[model samples]
Target chain A: MSVDPPVVHGHINGQVFSAAADATLLQVIRAAGLQVPTLCHLDGLTPVGACRLCLVAIEGHPKLEPACVTTVAEGMVVHTHTPELETYRRMAVELFFAEGNHVCAFCVANGSCELQDVAVEVGMDHSRFPYQYPQRHVDASHTQFSLDHHRCILCTRCVRVCDEIEGAHVWDVGYRGSACSIIAGLDQPWGEVAACTSCGKCVDVCPTGALFRKEDGTAEKHPHPERAAQLAEARHEHRWTNP
Target chain B: MATKPEPPAPHGLGDSLVERLHAVQQQHGYLPPEELQRLARAMARPLSEVMGVASFYHLFRLVPPGLHRCVVCRGTACFVRGSERLEASLRQRGVAFETASCVGACGQAPVLVLDGAVRSGDPGELPWL
Candidate 1:
C-alpha cells in the first residue's frame, strides 16, 4: 500500500486549505478553483518559472514569488490576486507583446493562443512600452515542423520539454537578453540538425504559434496540452506491458 | 633545474558549463559552434543548455572581434562625465569601439579600456583622444 503525501495547511487569498506537501502553490490554488495565470508552466514538465505572470504575494514576504514553483507549507498565506499583482501581470504581458513581433492578426495560433487569452483577461488593451520590432527569421527546415522566431517568448518550455521528456536536446537558445534566440544544434539551420527525432513534442507544448506543423494553415492549429501528462501517466503505469 | 608547477588542466566537462565556455573562449578568442558541440558531448549536457548559458552572459563572444577591441564605459557616472564625448572622438578617428553597460568603476568616470588597459579623465586629455 502506498501512503498518501503529507497535507500542508495554507491560506490562499485568506481561505484556509490543506494540500499535498509535494504539490506546488499553483496546483493548490488551481484545485481550490482560483485562477492564476501562467505562460511558461505546463503539466508533467519541470517548472523554470520563466514567465512572471503567476507571481503571488505571500504575507510577511517582502518580494513576490512565483506560484508555479513555490511549494506549499503549513500556515503560509498567499494572495493570488491583488491590484499590485494585476499591474505587474499586465506589464509582463505587455512586455511579451512588445518584445516580439507578435502580430496576432497574422499569427497561426490567433484564436487559440494562450498569450492572447491572457492579454485579454489581464485587460491589456495597448502596450505601454515601445515596440522593439526586432527583425527575426523563420525556419521551415524540419520535414514536419516549422519554427517562427517572431512569435517566440523565450519561455524555454519547448527547450525543457525537448530535453527532459523527449530526450532530444536539438534546440538551444543563442545570444543574450533582448537579442536571445532559439537555435537548433549549434546555431545551425533546423533542416541540417541530425539529432532531431521529428517527434513534434515541442510544437504541442508551445504556447504561441512559434512552433507548428508544416501542414497547419493560418489559425488552423490546436495544441494538445494534456499529451505530456498522459504520456507520463502511461509510463508510470507501465502500460507498455500489454504488448 | 627548478621545475614549474603544472598548470591547471584546461577547463573541461568536470567544471561548470559557464567555466567550460570561458575556457573555450580563452583558447579560441571566441566560441566556435564546432567546439561548443564537442564540449557538449564531453560534458554530457544538451546543446541547448550550453547555448543558453553561452548567450546569456555579455562576457562571452561568439564571433571574432576586430584588430583592437575598445570598450567605453556607459555607466551613469561615466555618461554624466562625458563618456559620449570620448566615444565620439574615437568614432571621428575611424576606430571601432563597443559600449559596455558598465565597467564597474563609477569613480573613474568617462573611462575607456582599449585592448584591456583602462584610461580615465576628460575626453581630450588622453594621448589617443
Candidate 2:
C-alpha cells in the first residue's frame, strides 16, 4: 500500500495554507492565488533559480531565498510581496534590461514575451544601470530558426529543455561571465550539430526573442511555453495521445 | 612552516576526464578541435558537454599559445599592486600573454610567470622590459 506525502502547513502573506512537504514555496504561492514574477522558471524543466526575480522573504532568515527552489516547511512564513522585495524585484528586472539589448518594438516575441510581462509587473519604467552595449551577433545558420545573442538573457531555458526533455543535449553554456553564451555542439553553427533532431522545442520554450523561427517577423513569433509541461505530464502518465 | 595545501579540483568534473584533458594539453600545448572531438568519442560523452567543461576554466587554452608564454596574475593582491602595468608593458612589447585569477603567491604582489618561472618585482625593472 502506498502512503500519501505529508502535508506541510505554512503562512504565505499572513494567510494559512497546506501543501505537500515536497512542494516548493513557489508552487504553494501559485496555489494560494498569489503571483510572483519569474524569468528562468518553466513548469516542466528543473528549477535552476538563475533569475533572482522570485526571491521571497522568509521569517528568521537573514537572506532572501528563491521560492522556486526553496521547499515549503511547517510553520514557514513567506512574504512574497513586501516593500523590500518590491524594491529588489524592480531592481532585478531593471538589470535584465540593462544587461541585454531588449528592444521590445523590434523583437519577434514582443507581445508574447515573459520578460516583457515581468518588467511590467515589476513596474520597471527604466533601468538605473548604464547599458554595456556589448557587440553581440546573430546566428542564422539553421534553416528554420535563428539565435540572436543580443536578446539572450542567459536563462539556460533552451539549454535545459534540449538536454532534459528532447534528449538531444545539443546546447550548452560556454565561456565565463560577460563572455558567456549558449553554444551549439562544439560551439558550432546550429545547423552543423548532427546531434540535434531538428525539433522546434527550443524555440517554443524560449521566454524571449533570442530564439525564434527564421520566417517570424517582429512580434510574429508565438511561443508555446505550456507545451513543455504538457509533454512532461504526458510522458509521466505514459500516454501518447492528448487526453 | 605550514605545508602547502593541494588546490581543489574543478567542480562537476570526473578526475579521469580532468586528467585526460591535462594530458592532451600537455602534449599539444592546447586543446585542438580534432583532439576534443576524439576525446569526446573516446569518453562516450557529447562533444558539446566536453567543450563546455573545457571552455569554462581559464587554464585550458583552446587555441595555440605564443612562442613565449607569459601569465600575469590578476588576483586581488596582484591587481592592487599594479599588475595592469605589467599587462600594459606586455601589450606594448607585442608579447602574447594570458591573465590568471591567482597563482597562490600573494606575498609577492604584482607577480608574473615568464615562460614557466615566477617572477615578482617592479614592472619596469623586470627582464621583459
Candidate 3:
C-alpha cells in the first residue's frame, strides 16, 4: 500500500492553506504568495534562524518566531505582515547597517546586494540605534576573491555553501561576540588555505559585498544567490546542467 | 614515481575532545598550530572545525602566554566585591592579565589566580600593588 505524506491545514494572514506537515512556515508563506524578508534563510541551504527578519506572529505564541525554522501545524494561525512585525523587520535591517560598515556607494555588491534589497523592502531609511563602527579589515590574499570583514553580516552563507555544496570545510566562524568573523583554515589567509577548491561557490552565495571577485570594482560584482539552490537541486537529482 | 609516506598518527588521547585540547594547552601553555592539527587528525574532524571550537572559548589561548600569568574572575559575585578595581589596578600597573567569567569560587569573592594559584582579597592586598 502506498502512503501519502501528511498535509496540515493552516491559516496565514487569515487565509486558509494546506501544506505538508514537515513544511516550514516560511515555505508555506511563500507558497501562499506572501513575501517574508530574510537574510540568513536561503533556499536549499539549512535554515539556521540566525537572522530575525523573517519573524512572524503566531496565535497563542507570546513571542515572534522565525518562520524559516518554525514548522507549520494543523489549525495554526500565522500572521506574516503585522504592524509589530513590520517595525521589528525594519529595526533588524537598520541594526545590520549600523553594526557593520555597509557603505553602499563604494561597495562591489551595491547594485545586487540582498542586504540592501531587504533594507528597501522593510523601508529602513535611518537607524535609531547608534552605529558601532567597529574596526574591521579586508582580506585580499586570495588570487581570485577578496573578503571585506566590514560588510559581512555573519549570515554564514559563505560558510555553509563552501562546506555543504563544495565539500570543502575551509571556512568557519572564529572568536566570540564582537570579535566574531569567518576564518579560513585555522585563521590562515584565504590564499593559504589549501582546502579551498577555488570553485567560487562562497562568492556566489554571499548576500553582501563581503565576498567578491578581486577584479570587480565598485558596483561591478553580480552575485547569483540562486546558484546554491540550483546546484543543490541538480546534485540531488543527478543532473549536471549549467546554472 | 615515489609515493609520499603517510605521517605518523597521533596517539589516542581518549574520547573527550575538549579534555584533549585542555591537556595540550596545559602542556604547551597554549594550543600550538601543529598540536591542534594533530588533534584534529586524531579526532577524525576537519582542522577548521577543531579550530572553530578551540577559538570560540576565551580560555583557549592560541598565542604564547606571558611570563607572569594572572587571571581575574569577572563573575557577578567577584564583580560585586570590586574585581573591576583589581583589574583596573592591574591595567594601571601595565601588567598583562586575562579574565575569566567565573572560577567556581564565589565564596571567595573578587578572586584572582596568580600563576595558577587562586587568591581572594582586596585590591590593595594584591602582591603587585
Candidate 4:
C-alpha cells in the first residue's frame, strides 16, 4: 500500500554501496566507483530513464533496472555487471549503432567518446542489425560547434542545455519512437531559428560525435569519473564551482 | 645522413589525405585543421604530415558543420524529465543529423552542452554532467 522506505545501503557485485535515503542508485554506485555506462542520466538534470543502457540486475527484482533512475533501499542487492546484463548492454549499444550513424573511424570523437568506449566494453565487434538510417539533420549555423545528423543517437543533451540552462528553450524533440530527433526553434534551421543563441551548451555534453565543438581540441579527452568524484566531493563541500 | 626536408602540400592537406578521408566518411564528415597541425607537430614532420592524416583518415571533419545541433541533457536530472520534446524540436526543424543528448546542465534542469561558456545567443555555463 505504501512505498518501501529507501535503501540506505546496497550490495553491488557483493560489494556494499551506501548513500543517503534521498540518493538515487546512480549516485550510490558512482560514489562507490563502479562503472555503469549511462548516456541520458546526468547529475544536474532530472532522471527520466530514457536511455536504458545503464540497466543492472537487482536481486529478487522482476526485471533489469536502470541504474540512473532507481532509488536505493537498505539491504538492497544490486548487480551492476553480469553476463546477462553485459548482453543487454551490448544489445543497447548495438541498437544505438544500428539506429543512428556511428562511424567511429571517421568521427571527430574517434578515440575519445563514451559510445566508442562502451562499444569496446560491450564487445561490439559488428552490428547484427540493419541501420535505421533516419534522415537526421546537421546544423553548423553556430560558429563554434556543429551537429552532424549522421552521427546523432537522439540522446537530447542539447535540448536540455537550451531549455534548462540557456533559458532559451530553443531545442526540442519531434516525432515519436524511432522517428524522434533533436529540433531547433519551433522546427526550423538553427541558423534561421531565432531562439538559438549559438551557444553550444549541447556539444560538450554529448557522449558521442553527434555534437562537437569546432574550436576545442579535436582529440577529445573523455571526462574520468574519478575526476567527477573529486569534483562532486569538492562541490558537495562547495569548493571549485563556487570559487 | 638524413635527407632534406620536403615542402608542405597545398592547404597543408596532402593528396591521399582528402581522398582517403572521403573514402572513410563517404560524403559524411570532414577533417579538422587543428588536429592535422597537431599530428604534424607531434611527428616532428611538416604540417602536411598531420594534414595528410586529416585528409587520409576516414572519420575527420575538415570544414565546419552546416547543421544545427540539439544537446539533450543526458545528465541524471534532465534524463528523468523526458527530453522527447526538445529532441523532437530539432528534428522537426529539419537538421540532417538527428538529436543527440548531453548533460548541458547535469546539476541544473537542462543545460546546453557548450564549447563556449557564455556568449550572446549562447546559453550560460553550467556544471558538467
Candidate 5:
C-alpha cells in the first residue's frame, strides 16, 4: 500500500551505483566504501562544509563541491580523488597547520587527532607556508576541561556540536580576521561560565587538542566523534518509546 | 479557524549576528570579550562562534584604538606615490597608525587619513609628526 522512494543513480570514480535520493553524496560514497578526508564534519551534526577538505569534482560543475552537503542527482558523476583535488586538499591541510600553532609534539590529541590522520592521509610531509606563530592564550580555568587556542584549527566542530546537538550554545567566536578565537560564555574564563553544564560534549567533538580533559597529558587525550552520531540516532529511536 | 503561530527563534540566535556585532562595535568602538560574551548569551550562541563572526570583518576592531588613527593607504596608486615613506615616517615618530588595502580615493595617490581627514601629497605636509 506504500510506494517505494525514488532511486537515484550516480558514478563515483567511474563506479556506478544507485542510492536513495534523500541521502547526501557523502553518505552514498561512504556506503560505497570511498573515504574522503574531513576535519569539521561529524556524522550527526548538520554538515557546515566549513573545512573545505571533502571537496570533490562533480562533472559539469565548474567549481568543486563539498560531498558532505552536496546531494546526489540522477547521472551525477563525482570524482573524489584527482591530482588537482589532492593538491587543494593538501594545501588546505597545510594552511590549517601554518595558520595555527598546531604543535603536534606537545598536543593532547596527537595520537587520536583527525587533523594528524588527515595530514598523513594527504601526504602533507611539510608545510610550504611560513608559520604564523601568533601569541595565543590557553584557558585551563575549567575544573574538568581546558581550551588551547594554539592547537585549534577553527573548524568549529565544538561550537557546532555544542550549539546544535548539546543545545548549550556555550561556545562562540570572538574577534575577526586572523585574530579570531573561541570563547566560553561571553569570553569569560571557562570555570566562571554558569551556563556550562560540564557536559564534556564540546571536548569530545573537537578534532584537535584544542579542547581536552584536564586530566590528560600530551597524547593522552581520546575523543569519540562517533558519540554524536550514536546519540543522535538513540535520541531519534527512543523518543517515542521513552514516553 | 486560525493558523498556528510560528515558534519563536531559539536564543535570538538567528541571522543577525553581524548586525548585533556592528551594534556592539558602535557602542564601544571595539568588541571586548565581556561584551561579546554578553551578546552570545543574549543571542543564545557560543562565545567562540560570536568571536568568529566579530573577527571576520576588517572594519571590526577587537582592541582599543589609539588616541589618533593614521591610516596609510596601500593601494597601487598610493604605493607609487610613496605612501611607504609616509607610513615609515609615522612609525619613526612613534605615531600609532594602521594600513588599509584601498581607501576608494585612487585619484589622490599617496593619500593618508590623519585623525579622520584624508589628505594627499608629500609626506612633508604632515606637520603633526
Candidate 6:
C-alpha cells in the first residue's frame, strides 16, 4: 500500500494557500495567480535554477531561492517581491542581454520570445554589463528549423526536451558556464545528427530565438497559445501515490 | 570522485526538455514507458500527471532510443505516402524507425533526414555545428 504525499498549507503575501509538500515555490505562487518572474524554467521540465530570476526571499532563510526548484513546506513564508530581490532580478536580466546575442529587431521570435518578455517584465530598459559578443555560427542544418548559436542563452531548454520529453536523448549541454552550447549528438553539426526526429518540440519551448522553425517567415509567428493551459492540466494529473 | 548521480531528471520539462534529457538518460540511457511514474516522484510531481504530459507533446519521445536515432515520418505528404512499403523498407534497412509527425517538413514530402541530414543528399548541409 502507498500513502498520499503530505499536503502543506502556507501563506503567500498573507493569504492561505494549499500546496503539496513536493510543490515548488514557483508552482504554488502561480497556482494562486500571483506573479513571480522566471527564465530557464518552463512548465514541464525539472527545475535547474540556472536562471536566478525567480529568486524569492524565504522567511528565516539567509538567501533567496529559485521558486521553481524550491519545494514548499508546512508554515513556509515566501516573499515574492521585495526591493532587494527586484534589484537582483534586474541585474540577472541585464547580464543575460549583455552576455550573448539578443537583438530583438532581427530575431524570429521578436514579439513572442520569452527572454525578451521577461526582460520587459523585470524593467531592464538598458543593459549595464559589457557585451561578450561570442562568435557563434547559425546551425541552419535542418531544413525545417534553425538553431542560431549567437542567440542561444544556453538555458538547456532544447537539450532537455529532446532528452527527457522527446525520449530521444539527442541533445546535450556541450559546455559549462558562459561557454556552454547545445550540441546535437556528440558535436555533430545540426544536420549531422541522425538522432533528431525534427518534432520541433524543442523549437516550441524555447524562450528565445535560439531554436525556431525555418519558414517562420518575415512575419512574426505567435508562440504556443495553449502551452500554459496544457502544462497546468498535465501537472495536476501527475498522480504518484499507488505503490 | 564521490558525486551522486544527478538522480534522473523528472519528466515534463515542457519546452525545456533539452536541459534534463541527457541528464535523465545518462542515469538510465533510455526512458521506459512505465518509468514516468518514478520520474514524477523525483521531480516531486505526480505520475498520471507526467504521462499526460509525456503523451501529449511530440517533443517527448515515448519509446526506447538507440545510440543512433532514425525518425521516419509516416506523414501523407512524404514520398512514402502512396506505397505501404516505407515502414517495411525502413525495417528491412535494419534500423528501428520511429513514427513521427510533420517534422515541420511537409513541403519536402517523402524526405527522410538521418540524424538531421537526409539519407545521402549532403552531410555538410547544415552549418550550425
Name the top DockQ candidate: 5
Q: Write the per-residue lDDT of candidate 3 for residues A1-243, one digit (tens) a residue.
A: 957769999799989999988788999999999999999978868777898999999898788888888888888899989999999999999999999998999999988999999999999989999999999999999999999999999999988898788978799898889899999888888999889999999999999999999999999999988988888889898766574
Which sections of candidate 4 miss by over 4 Å? A1-7, A215-239, B1-129
Select the stronger candidate by TM-score from 1 and 4. Answer: 1
Clashing pairs in 1: A172-B48
lDDT, candidate 2, A1-243, per-residue tens: 978889989799999999988788889999999999999999988888899899999998789988888888788888999999999999998888898888999999999999999999999999999987878899899999999999999989998889778978899999888888889988999999999888999999999999999999999999988878888877787755463
Question: Candidate 4, residues A117-172: lDDT per residue as tens digits?
Answer: 88888888888899877776788876666778787776676565455555566666
Deviation of model 2 at B72, angstroms? 1.8
Q: Chain A TM-score of each model, in the order shown?
A: 0.95, 0.97, 0.97, 0.84, 0.94, 0.90
- How big is the positional error of residue B18 in model 5, measured in Å on the Cα after superposition? 4.0
lDDT of 4 by residue, B40-106 (tens): 3444343323342453332355566664443445445555554454445445655343223443455
Tens-digit lDDT string for candidate 6 (A133-226):
8878888888788888887877777666666566665666654456567766544577766667888778877888888888885427555523
Best-to-worst DockQ order: 5, 2, 1, 3, 6, 4
TM-score attained by model 3:
0.91
The lowest-lDDT stretch of 10 consecutive residues in candidate 2 chain B is B1-10
Candidate 1 lDDT over A98-206, as tens digits, reads 9999998878898989999999999999999999999999999888899999999988878867776787878877787778898888777787888889888889989
Cα-based lDDT at residue A113, candidate 2: 95
DockQ of each: 0.30, 0.31, 0.27, 0.01, 0.34, 0.02
Instruction: Tell me which of candidates 2 and 4 scores higher on TM-score.
Output: 2
After best superposition, candidate 1 residue A112: deviation in angstroms?
1.2
Candidate of highest lDDT: 3
Q: Residue A141 of model 3: what lDDT?
A: 92
Model 3 Cα lDDT, one tens digit per residue, B1-129: 111223243345455878888999999999999999999888877678788889998779999999988889999999999999988888888988889899989999999988888987477677567
For candidate 6, what's the TM-score of chain A, rounded to 2 decimals? 0.90
What level of docking quality does candidate 4 show?
incorrect
